[model samples]
Target: MRAFLPLIALATPLALGACGDPAPTYIDQAWIRLSPNKDTPSAGYFVAHGGDAATRLRGVLTDYALKVEMHESMSEGSGKGAMMTMKPLDSVDIPAKSTVAFAPGGKHLMLWGVNDTAISRGKMTLTFLLANGDRLLVDAIIQKPGADAPAPKADEHKDH
Candidate 1:
């Protein structure tokens, strides 16, 4: 019985160590660039960190905006002669243990017909719909056109 007691203690720690909770997916540093012309669509950006499992960003929704879509801006040419083209994206994959950044001149959210009151408030709730049956709610900071929003920390941009 004494030998069995020692074995039980040895196994107890291993069992407890295996019971860790899975990391949850989340979003941070979310923001929307307000357009000077209300008629023009505004751009939104954020960083999404994947959980223990891989997932895709299927869509975005906000009650303050009439419509939202994911998009990517690509530069076709090289150097000073580069031309930018915007392409709509169906979804964005987030690999496990990685971070995806939606930044200026990169993958971003297109917000059309934003409510005037929401704009004046300087913030709004943005919901990110994930392919794996998870919805993340984040508050998006509103920035005036040409406002110098802070850049993402270097470490947070590991994967696009």
Candidate 2:
């Protein structure tokens, strides 16, 4: 019995480690910059962390905005100095155990026709549609033009 105790204790930890649950997929550090001109579209940013299985971000839905779409910002020199363009993204892949950032000057969300109430509240609810049929609900802080977003660390997106 005493000899078997050591083996059982060693096996117990290994068993738990092998059967441990994978980290859940989630969104973090989400925020939206409302366009000062209501006519123009606003921008949103966030970081999506994948879990054990890889997933793709299909789109974002928000009742506050008339339309929300995923977009990427790219800069190119078309013989006219530097020009920036926004391209609609059909989907973005998030690798397992990896993080995908929706940052400015990179991949981001374009929010159009945001409701006054939602803007006034200073927060908005965004539903992230994943390829795996999972919807992630996140509340994003809304920032007005010239309003300072909480000081973001380097690499985190912050609206200027």
Best by TM-score: 1
Alpha carbon lDDT of each predicted model: 0.91, 0.87
3-119: candidate 2 lDDT, tens digit per residue? 999999999989998987766678878889888898999999998988889999998999999999999999888677989988999999999988899987899999989988988
Best by lDDT: 1
**Residue 27 accuracy (lDDT) in model 2:** 87
lDDT of 1 by residue, 11-82 (tens): 999999998888878898899998889899999999899889999999999999999999999999999999
The global Cα lDDT (0 to 1) of model 1 is 0.91
Clashing pairs in 1: none
Off by over 4 Å in 2: 1-14, 78-80, 152-160
Which residue segments of model 1 deviate by more than 4 Å?
Answer: 2-18, 79-81, 150-160
Score every model by TM-score. Answer: 0.84, 0.81
